[model samples]
Every structure is written in structure tokens, then in C-alpha cells.
Target: MTSALAELSEALANVELTVPAAPARFLRLEFLEDAPEEAAAADVWSVTLDVSGLDAVPAAGDTVGLLCPNAADEVAAALDLLGAESRADRPCRLSLLPGTTKKAARVPPHLPEHASLRHLLTHCVDLRAVPKKPLLQALRDDAPLVMVAAGTGLAPLAGFLEERRARGQRAPAWLVFGCRHPELDFLLRDELEAALRDGFLSRLDTVFSRTGDRQRYVQHVLAEEQARLARWLVDEGAVMYVCGDAKGMAVAVLDEVVQTVAKAKEVPVSEAKKLVQQMQKDGQYRLDVWS
Candidate 1:
């Protein structure tokens, strides 16, 4: 694999300190900070360089190859190392080599095509060409849907709501979101409230854990609404989607969901577990979980 540092060096060699391109614009550079635990005494910085120079701009659902001079040189070096470019007068294509490095690029609907926001809300909301087809398809069906998210996890859920609205489908949807604080940490509160006002969302639940003396999370709210959740699951074939904080919050919420299902239905715990598992396998329970 080509090292990012080496690629940076090559980029410095080819391009001036700053150059302008009409079709492909150079975006800002981003330095990602390491997690608090990872950089106890020092700091870890991750740099992301963004550019938009392509034949056509990508759409929300589209993926495109991000090619640049540095990446091209890296591929050329690797090809030469492998003796793949030995032939004379042969045009070398950067993408032909198997191990060539090009960044995986996704087009974000909300972000300006020419500007880059590093680790910010716009950057996080950009849709990439990832394996979310299965999850999207699962949510496309006409069923009651419960979307649980934290922090930036609301991005995709907002996208899903936008998709439904565009298609003129009145899908029954509920959102249960947990954040650090209601006023401070809420990511898409205005947009969600607009959707609610438009009758696009049937219910909206917000949990702010740090606001109260005792922490109250989305799982606690789910427990409080156990009867409603259970009825939706059984009667309307409701699908549940959980996103964000895979290790602590997602796991805790899943445990609470299982317990709530068992308690509300008055079913054996084993049966409730089976039902939840079946729902997952059948694509009725979906997760876009991440840290």
C-alpha cells in the first residue's frame, strides 16, 4: 500500500502551494484529533485533504474515484516495482493496477461541492458509497419504523425521511434520539421539528442524559414507552433501527429493548430473544451502528 505521507510529498512536488481548478476545486485540509484515551499526554492528528475535480459531480447515492497527482505517482511507482509498466510507449492507466491507491469518494447532499468541512456536521452527513443498500431497502417497505440515533447518527435517518417525502409516501416513522444535552448536542433538531410539523414523523422522542442529575437515555424512554413499542412491534410489524455508540449505548439500548419486549408481551425471555433475533434476520430490525 502507498503511504499517505509519501503521497503528501508527491502532491507537494506537483502542485503549487495553492492552485485553482474550475471543475475540480481544492477543499480545505482537516486534522482529525485522536480520542482522549489514545492521546493521554500527546496528540494524534489525522489529516484529510479534500478536492472536487471530476468530469461530473457525484450525487447523494453515487460513489466516484478520487484521483490526484500524488495517488497517480504512487500507482506508477508500484507498477514500475511490479514491472507491470515495462512495455514501451504503453499508456499507463492509474486505475488498472490491482493495488493502486485512490481514495473512496462519496457525494454529500448537504455539503457544498467545492468546500470541505473536516469532522464537522456537513462532512459527517455526506453520503458515501458504502454498504447501506440492505439497510435502506429494509426501511423502504411500508412498515412502522422506529429510528434511534445519537449525535450525528441522525444524518442518515434524516436522509431516509427525505427519500420518503420525495416519493410521496406517508410512512409511519418515529424517532428516539439521545444526546448529551437537548440544546447543546442536538444535531438536527430544527429539521426534525419541521418534519414533525409537516406530519412526516408520527412521533419524536428526545433524551438528554447529561441534563438531569440522574442520567436518562433513550433506553429509559423506550422502557417508559414499552407498551406503545410492543404494540407497534406486534400489530404493525414495526422495524427498529439503532445507530451510534456501538460499545456502550447501542448495547445498553438493545438489552433494554429485549427486556421491554419480554415484559410488555408477558412472554418468556427466551421467546422474546427469539422474536428479536428473527426480526433482525428478517431485516425488520436494522442497525447502522458505529463508534
Candidate 2:
């Protein structure tokens, strides 16, 4: 039986399998028993197999196939040897066994060309990890800062603000977050309100594009508070951080900032642009952009 087990092990080792999704299942199964139910039913006969080699990457919602039935039998035999009870009439279905793949969470498709900018912006600010680093770094700089974020882009900004508050670093911070509707689309209203209540954030200006008579955005809010924003920029050496869709929101915010600086400081547009460029060179102006 030991010799047979050794042969089975060798055979199983050489077997190949393909999974249809990301290989998180194989990674997770490393610490789990091959037959958890059997292991629980008979502790003495329990077996745990380390089948990490079967890991494979596949697209979400794809199917996989195991080419070798003999290898599966050997694996089952190994589990059975550990006292895993099996019904001889209905052996475990190989196809039904957990695959080495995993399906990623479903995400909406990218906005179509004909979609409204508001719709595109709404879906652009995914709260995923790819854009968190820059946002967090900007928050940690401990200087007067203006954050402009539109649509779901507020997600990472919210995370950055929360992290700064958690670290007890309450440097004067301002947020200008724009969305389609304050009532229907506010992403982090509670958190922003709590920060305001606790004095973590100095000011929050919300612009709702579809609210009231005229459409408004973060850029509009910045324009409305040009004097205050200019004071923060020129007097306090405030940093500016913008996060959101890269297509229109970023460009529009930058243009609005330039215009606001020129109008408020009574300087030429070129001078305002140069001043913003200098701020960027000095690490006072940072952008975390994503499509």
C-alpha cells in the first residue's frame, strides 16, 4: 500500500489541470482539507492535501477542465487512506470539485462614447487599490490642501481623509467633491460630515451638476471661492490634489484653477499657469489620475 501510495503520488504530481479564473482558489485551498466533511466526520482518518501546483489563471466566469481521471483517482485514494469515507456508488464528481480559479467581482462596463459625462464620471472612481497610494501620500504632506474630486472619484479621497484623521494629522484640509446629485449620488457624505464635526476637515464644498437651475461642478465651486483658494495657494503655500476621471474632469479643474488664480491675484493667465507649474515642480501640486 505504501508503494502504491508512492506511485499514486508520483502520478498525481505529473498531472496537469487548467482553471478558468484567477487562481485564488488553489491558493486558499492550501490550508484546507481535500475532504473537509470527511475530516470532520472522522478525525483520525482526516487528510489534507497540498495541491498548490494546480494553480492556474482564467478569466472570470470561465470554465476549466482536468485532463486526467487517473490522477483524480489517485488523489481521492490518498484522501480515502486518511479515513475519508466515500460512497462507492457515487464517487465525488471531478467537474464539481472546486477549481483552482476564482471569479472576480463583476464591474460595470466602461462608459460608451454616447454616454453623458456625468454617467462616465459616476463610474470612474472605483475604490480599488490601484489609485490609493498617491492619494494617501498627498494627504500625509501636512500642509493646507485642496482636494478636487468628481463623481465616484471621491472614494479614494475619502479614504485618504480618513487615514489622515486616524493618524491625528489634522492639517487644514478642504474638499471639493462634485456629483450629479447630492441626494442621490453623494458617496461619502457621512464620513465627510463626521470629519467636519470632529474638525479634521476645514471645509467641504459640494457641487451637484444636475441640481438647482444651472449645472455646477467642482470647478464651479473653486471659481466661486477663488479668493479663499488663492489665499491658501499664495499665502499658506497650500498643496492641490486632484483625483478623478482623466478625460474631462482633470483638465477642467486645472483650467478652472488657472483662471481662478489669474482673476483672484490680478495676474495674466500665463503667469497663473507658470505659478501652477512651479507648484507642481515643488511637489505642492499633485495629481492622481485614472481612466
Candidate 3:
């Protein structure tokens, strides 16, 4: 009686298999802008990454992740600890994960198979990365959108706003942005106001936490507009998108929503919270926050 392995080998001993090579991915860092150098900036460092070897460019509101590789000395030190410094530039086998669907996971698709550490770090990896790579999803063209954010949170939302304008969309959009100071860290203040003047946004509100203003944070701004927000959701079929600090800003914004719903519907806080959860599940409210 032959073993299963032996039988399998014997059945196709003469058969040959051929595999095709995978394409390479390229990234070029084109520009970097720091907040300290610019007025109306919010302590943000914006870097632009140019990508190749992909099927399509990242559409509006989709920012690709780039990782800054370790320095040569750091890499050398780590390699010395492993006692494999000589193999630092060695080639490696390239293969896809087994049993994945045709969709083909594309997290780092710009890398070629059989690459070395130096090649990957110095040449392959780009700008940085997103933890857990959350998918905030795209907004519908048919529905109006309400964007609430602070500081760098405006990064992704800016893409959506511009894309809509480029597509000649005249829908009533709103942006409620918050920052530390208006003259110092009010990100994209001029551009935002331009959009407002262009009739792209029906309303644009800004808040400064450090400035002497009645609206300290975005939550305060939300409360002031609770009646209108409720109407937007209940009648105008608007989508709410919140992006920013997970710890502070996110919590405050959410708490305000819960309170708004509770007062407007005359329900208990617990019931209103449940309604907010349902709205999230129903795609009426979306959050993309990072800590």
C-alpha cells in the first residue's frame, strides 16, 4: 500500500507548472508642507505621495498610507543583532497569500516579490500608514453631506469637497471645522471660505478652542445647530461624517448628538443613544477617528 504523498507525487511526476511575475509599485514624495511655516495652519504636516503600479489612483477622500523607513544605521544595528548583516540585500521569493478571493488584497501592492530589506525600506515604502486601515466609505453623490472635523481631520474631507465641486455638484454641503487658533492653526481657512463663496457649501462654521469664542469646540457648534441638523437628517436626507481625535473631539461630538436626539424626540438618554447607534448601522452617520 503506497502512502498518499507518494501516490500524489507519482500521479503527476512529469507535470510542470509556470507562474507569471508580479509588477512593481513606485512611490515618489513630491512635496511637504509644515504648519509652522504657513498662516491659518493647524500644526499639521502635509505630504504628497505619487503612486504608480496600481490599477487606479486613490479617488477623492482616500489617502494612501506611507511608511518612513528606518535609517541606514538603525537598519545596520538591527541586522547586527540578528547576525545576518550579509543577507541584508538578498532577494526573497514573492507569492500571494493562499486561498484568497480574486479581489486580491492590495495593502502594499507596489512591492515586487524577492525583494530585500534595503530595497523595501529605501525604495518601496512611502509616506506612512493607517492603523487598522479603517474604511470610512465614500459619500453618496445624491445626498447632501455634513462634515465635522478639527485640525488635520480636515485632510480627507477636503478631498470630498473638492471632488464634488469638480464634478459640478451644486448640492448643499456644510463644513464645521475646529482648530486651536484662527490666525495660527485654522487649516485651509481661505480655501474653505472660497468654497463657501462659490455656493458649494450652504453653510460653513468654524470654532477655535484656544480663542475667546462662544463655540469652544465643534460639539458646541453642533448644539447651536441641533434644530437644523435634526431637520437635515429627518427631512433633507443628509449624511453626517465626523473625522478627528478619537479621544476628545470624537467623544464630545457624539455626546452632543445623543443629547440633541434626546431633547428633540423627548426620549431618555439611553433611548436616544440607541437611536444614534441605529443611525450608524443605517449609514446615516459615519465616523473615521484615530488616536
Candidate 4:
């Protein structure tokens, strides 16, 4: 071989190749709760992904990192940044820069080493699920659980209930879910009702915010269950988890629980808050929230 051709052949021999990760499929999307025809599809669409390509089976309470389509403005800005405005759909391969790995980089960690950018977006990267935050965990079989949430915040908690069913409900659990109205956007109604019937849930309380003359919220339910809440949290070592809107719902529920503890123990509200904080520190009370 010519010297230059020999060098080219050697370089080609040194190159590495790998099969790309298999892509996950969109399995189903269910309209949840009760909502007007126009609103049901828009407001309460629950998507289920086919993640069999994943290396690990997602345990209960896991979340997939989904990369949604960028807004037009975002796409335009990205194209401008790269000076590749005309090449938005250009085929491209994906690879880590030097000194980067899946764990350290923003790319989905489980993606195959070899994949095109288009393939990554369209087919791959959908099933990349990691564990939930340490504080928010899968349902444990050993203890009673109190779950509070509003709106679609019930999604992860629903996973917990399913886990309870599949694993054989060992401990009693209570769910307090709030939504706009019993007839509009009270998500997962059939399943939740079935859960109650099958003993997957020991109790299920729902509060509607925008229906009757007297509106109710999750905190209202908590306020009425004060004695039982205290017994669950203090006496039976039950775990309490609050999820959903941080600005309003979560704050209200926290306040209500603190008041319940204070009333039960005959302590000041300040002391009760501190006691509740201790429960959090001890991993008994947990929160997963967003604004």
C-alpha cells in the first residue's frame, strides 16, 4: 500500500463503532378525571411510554426525563447560535465532547454510545428514567402512608397505589386528592374507585375546589382528619407525603398538618412545626413539589 493509504487504513482500524440504543415508543395517552370535551384532551392527558428498551425496569415512583419539542423561538435561537439556520433538520451524529460522560452530561444517561441527533430525539432518549428524589420514594410495605396531592400531581402517587396492588397491599394507606370539581378534572376516578374497592387504598378522600357553593381543598380534608392524622404520624409511624403546587396547595397542607399535630399534642404551633420538621429529617414526612 502507498504510505499515505497505509496511514488512512491504520486510522480506520482504530475507529470504534457501537450499536445505538433502541428507541422507546409512545404506547398510550389517557384522558383523566372528568372534564368538558374540549378540556379533557388538553388539560388531563396522561401519556404512557413504552420503555421496554430501558436497561432497568422502572420501579414504582420513577420519572422519565422527556425532552419535548422546543418552542419556535427556542429553535430559532438555537439555530442562530450555531449559525446553522438552514440546517435545522440536517442529519448529525451525537457524541460526548472530551472529558464528558453520560453521568456528567445533560444527555440521557442510558442512551447508546452511537446514535444520530435525529434518532436521539425522535426514537431514543424517551425511556431514560432515574430514581425519584431520595425524599420521595416508592411505597413501603411495612408502614401506613398518607398521600396528599392536587391535579396531575396525583400521577406519581398513582404509581404508588399500583405498586401497592401488584405487591399485595400489606399496609393501609390513605389518599387525599384535590382538584377543580368532581365532575371536571377529578383525574383517575375509575382507577381510584377501584383501588378503594380492592383495598389498595384504605381510604380515599377527594376535595373539589370549584364546584359547589362551598369550595373544598385538600387541607380541608386534613383539617377534619386531625386526630387520625396525629395518630398516623405520631403513634403508628406512618409516612406522610405531600406533592403538587408549592405556592398554594403544599403550603396550605403543611400548615394544616402542623396545626393538627399541635392540637393533638397540646403544643404550640411553633413547636409543632419543629416536630414536623423533625419528622422530615427522620424521613417520615416528605414532599415533592413544583410551583
Candidate 5:
């Protein structure tokens, strides 16, 4: 007799596949700003885009695809716009996530009109929903939320915090943000400080890597707060969110988390790794990273 796998393969041998629909075109509104947040890093800036005509706006911590011609050193700058929202002026606000460079080129303050930008609106391609790479389902749970971010990684987390504040949801939240210098490189400093003062954020930790005697990244700061972090994870049932460059910062912070958890729980490294894996599987440890 034929095997079950062979029977299933034969049953679908002639099946036809369906193609997914294309994205809807959104109208580009206007450029708001591309001001530099840090004097030390001249190329790093906060960029904004105004958009309209979407069936639905993405929630906080969501991403939107953007195709801007001649914006970068490359042929075109196709970027993922973070912190998307619909504003009151019949326009949607697109806040470019922090630490973005177009082929290492500086972002101009103005967003020039391009052929593709015009065609997008004329063609009516939908960009309402962007695929989610990180799971933020923990926000819905009762567990405390701890956010770790560096450079542009803070953008989406900012949006998430704002949404939570707007909804009057005061779930405990801790933010650990790292930059080159606090005076010259801190992104959204005013907003973050206000959140802390107003009680939206339970804890706020900022790390400046360049000012210290030794170059200390966010992972170093995490190590210093290992006790608090471990307690949050093991006792409080906290959800950890990490966002940043995948090449170094994110990897380092993840290592710190596992090590701290192991020490806190008095377990072997392998067992600690299993705990991390389980957290990831259960959607408690979320990551949104890019190169």
C-alpha cells in the first residue's frame, strides 16, 4: 500500500497556487523634517513623511514600506518607515526609525518629488498592512514590559509607548536606550523625559557609549542592571523587547540577558539558553532588528 505522505502528495499534485495581492499606492503628503538629533553624528537625523489614503493605519511599533527615488547614494532608497500613524490633518505621519543611512549618505531635510512617488499615488497600490517580524503580543498580557534599544531602534518603541500613554494604560514599562552621547545624540529626549516625569515609564536608563572612559554599549548597561532585569524576568514575568542593529548591539544585549538570567536563576549556561528559547517561543522575548 502507498504511504500517507505519498497519498497526500498525489492529492495536491495538480493544485494551482494563488498569487498575493499587491500593495495599494499611498499619497505622499509632505516632508516634515530631517533634523539631526546628535551633533556628534552629523548624518543621523530624524526624518518624517506625510502620507494619506490608507484603508487602515498601522498601530504603534508597526512599519511601512517607502520608495523614495534619488534619496540615497544608491539608485533609490527603499526604506521601512517606522511609527506610522494617521494624524488629524487628513495625513498619516511616517517617522523614520533611528540610525538610518542611505548608503551611508546624509538625509536631506527636504523630500523631493520623484517619479515613483507620484506613480505610487496614481497607481493606487495599498500599503496598509506591513508584515510584522517581531511579536509584540506581550503588550496584551499582564507581564511587565522592558524595552531595550539603541540609535534608531528606539523609534518603534517610542510609538508603542505613546500609544500606551494615549490609551491611559499604565502597565509597568522600563526603557533602556543607548546612544553615542546624551547631549548630542539622544533621540526624542524631550518626549522620553516627559514620559518618565509623567509616570508613563516606570524606569528610564540612558547609556552614552562615547562619553565614558571605556566604550560601553547598551549591553554594558544591561550588565549593571542585571539584578533588576533578572528579577523582572524570573519573578515578575516580564516581557523583554530588543531593537537595534542586528550585527552587534542586539547580539550583545541578548547575550547579556541570557547570562544575567542564568546567574539570577543559579542554572547552567545551557539551561539558561533553554529558558531564553522558551521565552522566545512564548512571545515574551521580542526583537526587531535590521542591518
Candidate 6:
């Protein structure tokens, strides 16, 4: 990444965790729905929390990191071996995958000596904006959008679309999601299809790779839908948002988007690549990917 691009990403990205000024409160977690996008991939669940005791509840697109208590369990088991003074509050860092566009925050020691399993759970928020901030913002003006996601990366975009629908926004949008299996891991399948039914989502597409002999991905779906994608970008001025595995899915999807631009404008591949870079610089092409 260029220095300028790195700077822009840092300026626009933030990670906030629940602080230790006050002891953490235990809130109930409610399971809403689970949308499996891939059978072998992690399942994306739409769960609701009883955030009544929290200082402030995380809004849509915000993440809640549930810190495991295994370490705490070990600590308690050895409490007799280690004296009280040795048990001084220690901070735990919840690190996300490292990237130029990413950062981490410490999980505060916000619990009592006998903190329970619930107290160990922490909330790591993205204070600046959700990964799909640009797409959500575009809905305020009802701008056209193209959202592409794979596996569990569908969480933020699904939340954004749900919020838009709740607010009665009529932004034309397309969703191209890729996963291992639709039946087992098509997260938010019902909600997305409902959005399409109600006219909130302009189009919806899905790819299940493991279901067939050939391995297909979301980028393949993007290539198949290049005509619509080209029109969305070159003609309608639609913004693009991609969230998925950075190593493979995100890279391939980006290549296809750039190629779509080049094909639509009949420009050299180099020029098209630059146009994609410019879009990222301008925050029109946003990505939230992890290895």
C-alpha cells in the first residue's frame, strides 16, 4: 500500500473496546438467527443482546468480541499458588489480524477477583464506522450500491441493509455473496431474500462452491455479473464494498472490479487499475478483509 493510502485507511479506521473505569456488567445474549454461508466456514449468527447495563450499546455493524475465560480459569485454579498481590489487575490485548488498515485494543481488567464467565466477555467496537460505513452512508441519499461479501464477512453488510430497510430507504443495491454451502451457511438468506422481495435490495446472487465438483467463489459470481456491475459503476456511479478473506477472495474480487471498470470504459488495464486505486483513495471502494 502507498503511504497516502495507508494514511487514509488509518484516518478512517478505529477500534474501541469497553473500558475498565467501571466494572463490566453482564448482559444477556439472545440467539436470533444463524446464516451459514459456508458449511466448512464459520457460521455468521444474528444475535441480540440485552445491553441494558452497558454504558452504551453497540450500534449496527459494531462488533462484540467475547473474550474466552480459559485464561481466567487457569488464573483462578492457581490463585492459591500465586498470592493476592501477584493477582494485580492485568490487561489483556484483543488483537485483530494485523494490516495497514487495522488496529487492536486492550481488553480492560474490568471485573472483580471472582469474575464469572459472563464478566470475561468483552465488547470490541469499531467507533469510527462499521466496515460497510460507506455503503450505509450512501443509503442516506439513496445512492446505488454494490456489496460483495463471502462467508462470515456478510455480517456488517447484512446489518447495514437491515438498518436501511427499517428506515424506509429505497437505495437500489446488489449483493453477491459466495460461500461453501448455501443450505448449511447462507447467513441472512431469509432477510436478504425478503429485502429483494420488498424492493429494498435490487438484486441478490449467491455461489456455493463445495456443492459442486468445481470450486467457485464470489469473484466468479462477480465475473458472471460483470455487465450489471459495469453499468452500476460506470453508468449509475455506484460505490462498491467488499468484505471477506483478504488473501484470496478480496484480492480476486478487487481484480474483477477493476477489470469491470476497464471493460466498461474501454481503457487500458493499467488505467483501470489506477481508477480502482483512485476509488479507494476517494473512499468509494471500501474493503474490510482479514486473513
**Cα lDDT of model 6 by residue, 1-291, tens digit:** 699998987877875556769668788887745544432666355687788998875555565555443444455444434454243345433333445453544334444334432233322222223243333333345578889998888878887787778778768888999878767777888898999999888898999887776789999988988998898888988878898788999999999998999999999999999999998887778887777
Per-prediction TM-score to the true structure, in the order listed: 0.57, 0.53, 0.71, 0.68, 0.63, 0.63
Q: Per-residue lDDT tens digits of candidate 4, residues 129-184? A: 44445545685578899999999889889999989889887587999999886776
Over 4 Å off, model 1: 1-135
TM-score of 1: 0.57
The candidate scoring highest on lDDT is: 4
Better of 3 and 5 by TM-score: 3
**Any runs in candidate 4 off by more than 4 Å, and if so which?**
1-42, 69-135
**Per-residue lDDT over 1-291 for candidate 2, one digit per residue giving the tens place of the 0 to 100 score:** 999999999999999978687656543335642333222221112134344675653221122222222344454454466454343333222222255354653333332434432222233333222433342353445678788998766765666676667677689999999877666667768889999888888899988776577877787888788888888887788888888878888988889888877887789999999988887888787786778
What TM-score should be assigned to candidate 4?
Answer: 0.68
lDDT tens readout by residue for model 3, 1-291? 469888888878877868888768686675654333345443468676757766786778675654666577766776677686898788865576787696956545667776886666556654233456456666777888888998888988888877778887768798999997787877878878888888777799998876563438999999999998877765686888899999999999999888878887889999999999998889888888898
Question: Number of clashing residue pairs in every model?
Answer: 2, 3, 7, 1, 9, 5
Model 4: lDDT to the true structure: 0.80
| Clash count in backbone of candidate 1 | 2
The predictions' CA RMSDs to the true structure, in order, are 17.8, 26.6, 20.8, 20.8, 20.9, 21.0
- Residue pairs that clash (backbone atoms under 3 angstroms), model 3: 25-110, 41-185, 66-126, 66-127, 66-128, 67-128, 92-114
* Top of the candidates by TM-score: 3
lDDT against the true structure, per candidate, is 0.67, 0.67, 0.79, 0.80, 0.74, 0.73
Cα displacement (Å) at residue 174, model 2: 0.6
lDDT of residue 106 for candidate 4: 61
What does candidate 3 score on TM?
0.71
The predicted structure with the larger TM-score, 4 or 6, is 4
